[model samples]
Target: MDSQKRLARTAGMYYLIVAVLGAFAHIVRAQVYVPGDAAASADNVVAKASLVNHSFVADLVQATFLVFVVMTLYRLLHHAGKNVARAMVIFVVIAVAIICLNMIHQLGALLVATDPAYAAAFGVQGSEALVLLLLDLQHFGYLVAQIFFGLWLFPLGLLAIRSGMFPRLLARLLMVASAGYLLDVLLQFLTPELADAVNPVLVTLFSVAEGSMLFYLLIRGVRTLRPAEQAVLAA
Candidate 1:
């Protein structure tokens, strides 16, 4: 297939995979965790998670999907007639780098758990004394990337909103998603734990935004980002 057709095929699926991952991570866990009197005990949480079968393949799939999704979004921006290729490229590069760093940090933390004796001999630990100190370079990278992503979404939302090319509903949704991300950033400083506890909600809002935008971009081919409007959204 030609590049355009290939791009068209991928445009919609990327956001859907994001939603699926969210459901698996949140909804599935919620089901397994139960609630109230019948809730799984703290001890049982690990056991129940274990029963679900920890598959490295799942992680690989998610990582691969995100990479492709980034690539697809780059192309989608091109299709939107916005001169955003360089910005999108930078976004993808940072995203991949941070995610890779996160995977490594997670692995390092795991090694400490599975081999405490060996880890101690090697001077490794599952967790450091301070949570802030414990945050690896990747965690910080992820946070910075999220801020960038939120910033990026504003231009995207404005493009959708002004162009009249997309459904106003989807455009509104994207704006809302952009707001949710900014909210996450603000909430992070005031209360990290609370922000994290409600992270799924924030992410869900973002997904609704991206999912709506991606769907319209695919089916309707909205080319709304006029030269002036692009700058406003880009801001």
Candidate 2:
């Protein structure tokens, strides 16, 4: 019971983290980022839309994001055992892979931005080829990460819902949240034109998924603690 409470507390902390990060991103987007883009050139637009500065905010937020993902999946992989930690380490591996991919793409974009020869060739006049390239990489990278996060959470949501470890409603909420994320991503892919428009509804619904799950964790987490069951499975 105590263990469950502790986990719930941690889950609450994660909610705070996500909420704070999202809020701060919104503030910056409103004041500085969007205004700067309006004045930027069309050629520079793609690069600006590449999400260079936006990516940095996301980078900071995601630094510890994987930790929560790993924590939630740990119980599932080990079923609660001494090896739970081992299972969680797989997430760490995923994080490293993502970081590596981002680094490589960022570097490639950098080369594009700085190489005046390449810039001239592409007819990229306003935005540095390197800057736009990097932004492009960052934008795509963000989308990829979102896909992974949604899919990753899907199973976790199912697990909690099916385990009968918490209230049925909690599970339902998770399922709904998962669906929202999936839908949001699919919508983004369908509308290539709106990809950079930053529509308010899209952003709003996209975040509901996270908020729903966080609510469940903070509220019903006490009922979901299954360390003994987890230990048996881990064995």
- Per-residue lDDT tens digits of candidate 2, residues 1-235? 5665566657656656756764654443333222224223233334544454564456456546556645644543334333434533553546435654664554454455545666677666543534544545655564565555555555555555544455656556555655665566666678855654644655565466556556656765546447786565346
Candidate number of the best TM-score: 1
lDDT of 2 at 103: 48
Worst 10 residues of 1 by lDDT: 126-135
Give the clashing residue pairs of candidate 2, or none: 50-135, 80-230, 112-130, 113-129, 113-130
Where model 1 places Cα greater than 4 Å from the true spot, the runs are: 1-6, 22-60, 79-81, 119-141, 159-165, 193-204, 214-235
Clashes of 2: 5
Worst 10 residues of 2 by lDDT: 32-41
**Candidate 2, residue 71: how far the Cα is off, in Å:** 1.8
